[model samples]
Target chain A: MNITAKAHEDLILVTVGEDRIDAACAIQFKERMRELTQAPSSRVILDLSTVAFLDSSGLGAVVAVMKLLGPDRKLELSGLTPTVAKVFHLTRMDTVFTIHPSLPDGLQKAG
Target chain B: MELVFDSNLDAVRGGLADLLDSGPLCAMEADARGTAEIVLAEVFNNVVEHAYATRQGRIKVCLKNHPDGVLVTVIDSGSPFPQQQLPQGLLPEINAWDDLPEGGFGWYLIRSQVRHLSYQREGKHNRLTFCLPY
Candidate 1:
């Protein structure tokens, strides 16, 4: 559940620094997300480039985070590894959120 | 290849690591290996969360490589399925964002990734078998 949050001008770019998010750490992941996303930001972009694996529990945790953001705010995702992307695709959750191939140009250099 | 571990979420992670890092699973292509991990994790955790709920037990996993794919059998000394049968594994309905599903995707994922899913209860154990195509 290692995640770092950087505040851009209008959004918070949160990068997950873990290789796997599964049943073992799904709850902690959600709780940490709640704490990191407390600051007001219209949009939050989650970078999952480093995450090589995510199971159903991990996927649910991501959905829970999006719901926590509520209607006013948005939770976008970027850098979905093949396995993580497959989970979203199979569950049809891919259509539920806005997915980016990678971070926008400005934030790319921040990492 | 066979692996036995305590029925806990953390142990499930460690067991998967061990299973994937050695044996035939270790030699799989990257994409196939990723799918194997995802499908196996869901299956193992379900037994920990549902079958062994509020109790402690051991889970045994056996993997055999075939010409087409790898066959997996997971045995647990815990509760059987509600009606001694598997779930329909239909996709959960996607509703409003606020009401989106946070769970119920486990069976769907397992069902989608594996083939020839079979569940049987013999004596005091529950046996679930599935095949992962390479």
Candidate 2:
């Protein structure tokens, strides 16, 4: 899995360039998200445009990041592909976090 | 038997999809695409996670179109997951309104999807095989 981080304004955007963020990459993904959230950002947008699939491990990693962010910070999701989005929806996580259709939408909403 | 992936999850799915697309297994009455993908993801994720904990390891996956259904086997030298000790019972009722929990659902999905799932540690390698029947 390849993850690229870019800081924009008070938001840190982490774009994941992996097909699946399952158990294999969950720990690393969690670690990176943790580091990003610690830097004082109002919002963290997880760009999943390139991610095609996610399983329990991948979902756990996202949840872990959400927990680390606590209630003070905002963690939003964007660009969830149909398959990936289905997993979130099936787990009922769609209602738990703010999910946007695109990066700009997520950023605009966060702003 | 068809060889489609070289251990990577993306490649594994691609291989599985391609094989299913070209083989007789594709015509099966049951919808195993989603189930197969989920099961493969869980097993492959385990390889990418625990087996290659510090160093990178390679995994070999093979899908065989059987007379009854399909047999998928993942072979890796990484850490092994104990199939016998798997948690058994009904799926936990998920409250969609609340936050989602991480990790346990993979096991739940794997158990629910496949008919006979087994994991065996052979020497230093682990082989996880699951049979999905039509």
Candidate 3:
């Protein structure tokens, strides 16, 4: 789970640098996410543009990150590939997270 | 094709990826390969977490490819599911993030992606068979 985090204003944009997030990387993803998100701003935008595939474990990891962010902070998602978006839609997780079509869309809105 | 591996997270991921090779049934259509990949990942992880639990064992996976669809069979010798059956229907009623669900979406995603899914326990082995169209 090679994830990169950068802060922009009151938002922190985290990008996942992996083609797939499954059971193999779910733990690592969550652990790294917790570290990256320790110092939170008003919002955190998770960019999944590079993630071509996501499983339930991956979905859970995202949820965990969201909870770790607590209620005061917000977690948004962007750049979901078709396959990755399908997981969110099928699980109805799309309703839980504010999703954007692209990183720029989320970034602009967050700003 | 058959794959037998330790009931571990890493192995589960590798096993699901192995099923998505560039074969005929593994063709790319409506993101079917991606569907199978996600479905297999969820189902395989369930076996490792629930069936195998903390016990060390091997999960036997078989992939049967057909012109119309593909059948995936997963066999594990650990404890059978609590219900000894697949959850009826899929998706849970999740409309808000107020009480966001942290889990319980694995089976729903699996069922929604596949053409058919089934689970059964024969003696000491739990057999789960699911099929998806390409």
Candidate 4:
């Protein structure tokens, strides 16, 4: 799995490069996100533009990251492919996190 | 035949995709193909992670294409899971950020994606079967 993190003034944008994020990479993905968001940032935007598939474990990882960020920090999801978006909708996670159409949009909203 | 993967999830997915891409099973439509791939990846990930605990183990994937659809059976001698007894309901009220719960959504995904789902434990072996209509 390839994960790239770009830090902005108030937000960090992380792009997931893997086509699928399941049990195999869920732990790694969560740890990487945690490391990226450790410093105090206004928000975190997860760019899933390349992710084609996600399972329960992957969802759990994202949820865990949100909890780590807590109420003080905002977490947004952007560029969810059709399949990945379906999972979020099915689990009703679309209601939990702020979903944006793109990273720029998410950052703009957060800012 | 029993297949072994060295803790590589993509390799297992690729192997399954190759198997399903050939023979009579290749006739599956695009939607069915997508659902089948998702189901396969979910189950295979379960076997590799929960069952084997990321350790080395053997996964037996049996595929059969019938007139109705395609049947895929996964058998592993790893940790046993009581998937049959899981409660069935749509918890739309429960938000994702709420209190964490265990062993609910994975079964939901499996039930929702596959046409049929059944689990059996024959002694040490845990067998899970899913069918997809072509």
Candidate 5:
């Protein structure tokens, strides 16, 4: 559950440095996300490029983070690997959140 | 391919990595292999969470090549399913933002990817079988 967050303008870009988010660390992931997202940012984009695998528990953790963000804030995603993308697609969570193919152009260099 | 490990999340993680890295699993098409890993993880972790909920136990996973796909059998010396039945695994209805689901996707993911799923309580052991199609 290694994640780094940097505020770029109005949004906070959080990158997951771990390769897998499964049952083993789902709770840690959620806790870490809560810590990283403490700052008031309208948008929080999670960079999952490094996360190759995410199980159902991990998906649940992600959803919980979104709920924790509440109505005014948003939790978006970017760079979902194949396996990770499959989980989102199968669960229909892909429709719930706004997804980006990669980091935004201006933020790519910062990430 | 067959392997047995103690019932725990870390062991489930390590065992899944080993299983996906060896033998027929590694040689599978990327999509098929990914599907296999996803299905197996959901199934195995379900056993770790539910079957062995209150006590310690062991889980055994057996894999074999089938004409249509790969056959998987998981056996665990843990509690039997309540009423000796498998869950229907209906996708949780997505309603408002307040009602968003935080869990219950495990069996849905497994059922979506695998076929010929069957379960049996053999004395004290729970035996579950499914096929991952390539």
Candidate 6:
């Protein structure tokens, strides 16, 4: 239920505060993101460093956030736990967004 | 061990996490535990969202530890699986950013990581089983 948002230069970083993005919070997660992005940015990143678990509903929430950004803006990802990373890889969503091992790495890649 | 869980969304997930926390089955090889957690969460959430819908119902979860893996049997007295036939080897094509699919990845993820995944409807109860065989 805790979704944090910040701005890093050109990119706005939204961090997931919960250990899981499952059904328990997916809908709320999406709703929160809609509110988080009320002040829009050209580039966005979802920081999943604290997220230890993810399910399809969680994954869908991420996808929905990505779509909300539209084509002009991009949603990059940083700090994906193995299980979460596996979900991205298995679903071939790793190709959909730029993913990095850490926020620094994501920043470096964004440059 | 068996648990008759509340049909609430949070209850299904929290109940499974509690069950897994009460055992070493989640400590299996590599990502075995995470895989089991996600699969179980998906199925249980599906029951609450689809089967139970707006109505409250009973979901019986039986956790049997086997030599090779853990066998999870979830019995629910709600509507049967809506999909007439579960899709086989469904790997959605996400070639581009716009190609990204928002939903429908739950069963695919479950089937890909699990073994002996089976489902049945006995009268009013929908029985689904799968193994976290590491």
What does the interface RMSD come to for each candidate?
0.8, 3.7, 1.6, 2.8, 0.6, 1.2
Better of 4 and 6 by TM-score: 6
* Candidate 4 or 2, higher TM-score: 4
Docking class of 3: medium
lDDT of 3 by residue, A1-111 (tens): 589888897889998888988777888999998899877599999989889988877888898888888888989998899989988888778888899898764364442
Model 6, residue B103: C-alpha shift (Å): 0.4
Candidate 6 lDDT tens digits, A1-111: 788787766778788788888878888999998888777688887889889888888898899888888889988888999889988888888888888788864454342
TM-scores, all models, native as reference: 0.97, 0.64, 0.88, 0.78, 0.98, 0.90
lDDT score of residue B82 within candidate 6: 61
Q: Per-residue lDDT tens digits of candidate 5, residues B17-43?
A: 898999778879999999999999999
- Candidate with best TM-score: 5
lDDT of 4 by residue, A3-71 (tens): 877778778887887887776688898888888787788988888888887877788888888888887
Rank order (by DockQ, best first):
5, 1, 6, 3, 4, 2
Tens-digit lDDT track of model 5 for A9-86: 889999999999999999999999999999899999999999999999999999999999998999999999999999
Q: Cα deviation of B129 in candidate 3 (Å)?
A: 1.6
lDDT of 5 at B46: 91
Best by DockQ: 5
**Model 3 DockQ vs. reference:** 0.65
TM-score, model 5 to reference: 0.98
What number of clashing residue pairs does each candidate have, in the order they appear?
0, 2, 0, 0, 0, 0
Candidate 3 regions off by >4 Å? A105-111, B22-25, B95-98
lDDT of each: 0.93, 0.70, 0.81, 0.73, 0.93, 0.81
For all candidates, state DockQ relative to the true structure: 0.89, 0.29, 0.65, 0.32, 0.90, 0.74
Model 3 chain B: worst 10 consecutive residues (lDDT sum): B17-26
Ranking by TM-score: 5, 1, 6, 3, 4, 2
**C-alpha positional error of residue A104 in candidate 2 after TM-score superposition, expressed in Å:** 4.1
TM-score, first chain, each model? 0.97, 0.88, 0.92, 0.90, 0.97, 0.89
